[model samples]
Target: MAKIAFILLCHKDPDAVINQAQSLTAVGDCMSIHFDARAPRAQFDTIRDALKTNPNVTFATRRVKCGWGEWSLVQATLHALHAAVAQFPDATHFYMLSGDCMAIKPAQYVHDFLDRRDVDHIESFDYLTSDWIKTGWREERLVYRHWFNERTQKKRFYAMFELQKRLGLTRAIPGDITVMIGSQWWCLRRQTVESILEFRKQRPDVMRFFRTTWIPDETFFQTLVRHLVPERDIDSRTLTFLMFTDYGMPVTFHNDHYDLLLSQDFLFARKISAEAHDLRRRLGVLYACEGARFRISNEGRSLFTFLTGKGRTGHRFAPRFWETESTLGRERDLLIVLCRKWHVARRLVDCIRTSTGLPCIGYLFNDESCALPDLGGIQDSMDKRHRHRRALLRMLYEHYDSDRLLICLDPSNLDLIEDFCRDRSVTRLLEIDCDFSDRDLIEHAMRVGLAGDGTPPETLARLLPTIRNDMALETDTLRDRNFAHHSRLREADPPARNARAIAAFLDCSEPIAGALATTDQLFAE
Candidate 1:
């Protein structure tokens, strides 16, 4: 196994970044560089002073602009690669890293395992479905599209949708591409590094697109390599790999799950706020023989199953239809924010209790649970069932929070709720809104809680008067309260409807991904 190295590339110094970097440098030799010219010169000044005693640290040439539309990232990657090679020429592979990442495993164990991969590039990855490519998105790319001139911006919906639909029917299209690259950090062998560098020297187009294109470095590298060597043995599934023992086509994030892949796994270990200090803490542990393996909790997986189940962010499928209804012909918008976690359900339960004045039935169903029979008296919620004879007792519970959820109900479901609320006095109001009249839906009610894990409650609080005035809520008691603000349903966020994009993405050639000794246009027309 080659000695693992730390290639810390950063732009600015946040309060805890350097402290974080110091933590990550434990597993191997460390090289630190800043894209100094494009950012404030004093960005990581405190970091430099702190590291003055560390003789092995290296810095990039000052005044270099690591712009979005240029080969600056490649430049930075190469800079670290070239420098690391000089310091340790005999090392077999180098793990490219970012300042924000923390190694979940011990350093020696990580290096030893990383060094053992059969392929040159050990970035864990799988092929992307047509959906991801057409609808491929993240915060950064969204920012890029916003910078588009008016024409290009509109061209996206039309062009992307058309291409995506076409791609689905003809999945073997030659020049078009698919496959999401793993993140910027990959356990790449020295050979892959040389190949990418050689290509940089030979193909300015690749470099130009990387810089000028708003594509993040993660997708850019894999795309470039795939176009170069479509048949290569590259692991498309990078960050969360070890759990997957299968090497099948159409690789997905779900292949090797740690029971429930909670939001914590998705967020990786570092917070956007404390990311700076993670490096040092991680590095210290790496030196102590811990590298980068993250321990996952079971609760996370259960929640993940819930969130990703509907093919939304993190839902895994549940066997039966779990209480959902639809307004098939209603020209209304239903903006649903759901996750597979019990906490999300619990929170929603609370909201429902406060808003709807009706008592609720909280049923905890087992996978073996059968459907409930419908009786004539209760109301229905979308499509979920409630009233039954044999399995009735096991499926019903008193929900203190059901009324606030505000769903149209069937008679059986209503009766179920009434039955479950034992001894408690409950009042049933038969009022319902068919034309979107009730504006206090949960989506509009919770904007304050959604605004940036932030603490601007006063700023949010001040807007209450205007909101109350608009709603025509007459009472003085309602003035300062955080009430539901109904939003007009617009076309569901457009990029989400990537009709053209999805088609184009689906039809692209599969990655000849794997150990790349010969990726010279293997899938060319």
Candidate 2:
């Protein structure tokens, strides 16, 4: 049987890392770990000692003192990959993973899957065109030289980043290279892995360029693969399942997420915490019982409808939201704006903010547009993206003060508004609905390249019906809203539309002049 190599990167959870490594070793896979150099000596020794007896296990000699959004993260991964390739020359495929990741498939099945496939299981997309570019920051990552180090005073660093951004100081992307970004975890063929190492040795300039780039791990290998070996088939989806909150923070996987995990076709699931003993135990039992089939349980079958909306024009699975209470005890009025069309919702957010004189923050669930403010923070890894989002959410909730608040979020994240209110003891739930047919949303999505791969029509044919069903289900859930599409809400004139929607939802006696002015100006332009 062909052997596989596992490159495991870890920082905080040594025990979980060891347990995961031991589990993988059962199938006789070679393992190499790159513990963060910033981690304490005691933690490192504990992990080292736990796996010391395992002859197949190796450690990266040059551990990196990793920092978020710095070159160190990529360097650490490179160190591990190099060490693994050197020690396990016979290994056929190498799987890059984190300490928190756990296998959902049997070792034999995973081995078979890798052995049979010639394609590299890596997610890669043109950074310029990807829908998640959020605020042209993707362009800035490559175009600007990030000067502020993450270890210093963050407030000052962010101020500096903004100052630089305002100054329009940007560098041109290298003529020879096209930047690509995607999920960091990947399973690469040994040859592909070796090629990357060789390329890195030959091209120090490219490596240096990426060193200052934000979240380069998401792009470095992916960009190199596309440039060096375009002929090599690449699968754009990762096998690891990670659940995120409305704010883009990773939701901790607990017992409730078990069925959710089983519903996916992924071989592994990430972000399993050390505290999830029951879930870990159940996972072990699942692998032992089912081997590689990865069948959904009878109970989980019932959840399938919930997981993937069915029987609707556009079915929408219930998007998960993490519930956290705000510390503020004072009750504030909330203007909840929910819609499937993000662009429309975004406009509505601006209208509501102007109308209510409250700042609006959109929690995007779908990949609609990439224009977002470039958040100034260094991420040590791609996994930290959610952490940054969570921090952003906390900061906004804690710092922003107003009598009224306008929140623009994807329809999928509507439940979060309820959680937010409940935490703040707000009794009134004012819901504003944006009206658009499933067809309209689908058409817009297809136009924006959100539907799927290929040409609009082809991708539409492939993805529209499913998305339509999802939207229909979502619409149904929000059917009881104060305002809705194809209802009395649509009767208003175009110039007074947003004002009417707000008036109708909030039951206000008078229209806010700001909203009317914005609507008039928007229509005029």
Measured against the true structure, the TM-scores of the candidates, in listed sequence, are 0.44, 0.57
Q: Who wins the TM-score comparison?
A: 2
What TM value does model 2 have? 0.57
Q: Model 1, poorest ten-residue lDDT window?
A: 508-517
User: What is the C-alpha local distance difference test score of each model?
Assistant: 0.39, 0.65
1-525: candidate 1 lDDT, tens digit per residue: 665445566666544556545554534446545544655757657667776676555565433555442445656666776666666565566665554444444556555656555454533243444333334344333223222322335586446535645665222212344434454656656666667667778866445445533444555666656655545556554543222112312222321221222212222222222322334443344445623444433233332232333223222232224223311112211111111122333343344444333333333221113223343423233232332321232222222212121222221132332332221222122211111122332122233222122213332243344444433422222223222321111112232222222222222122211111122321121
Ten contiguous residues minimizing lDDT sum, candidate 2? 483-492
**lDDT string, candidate 2, 52-140, tens digits:** 99978999969898877777788999999888998888888888888878777777767677767687888888988887455436576
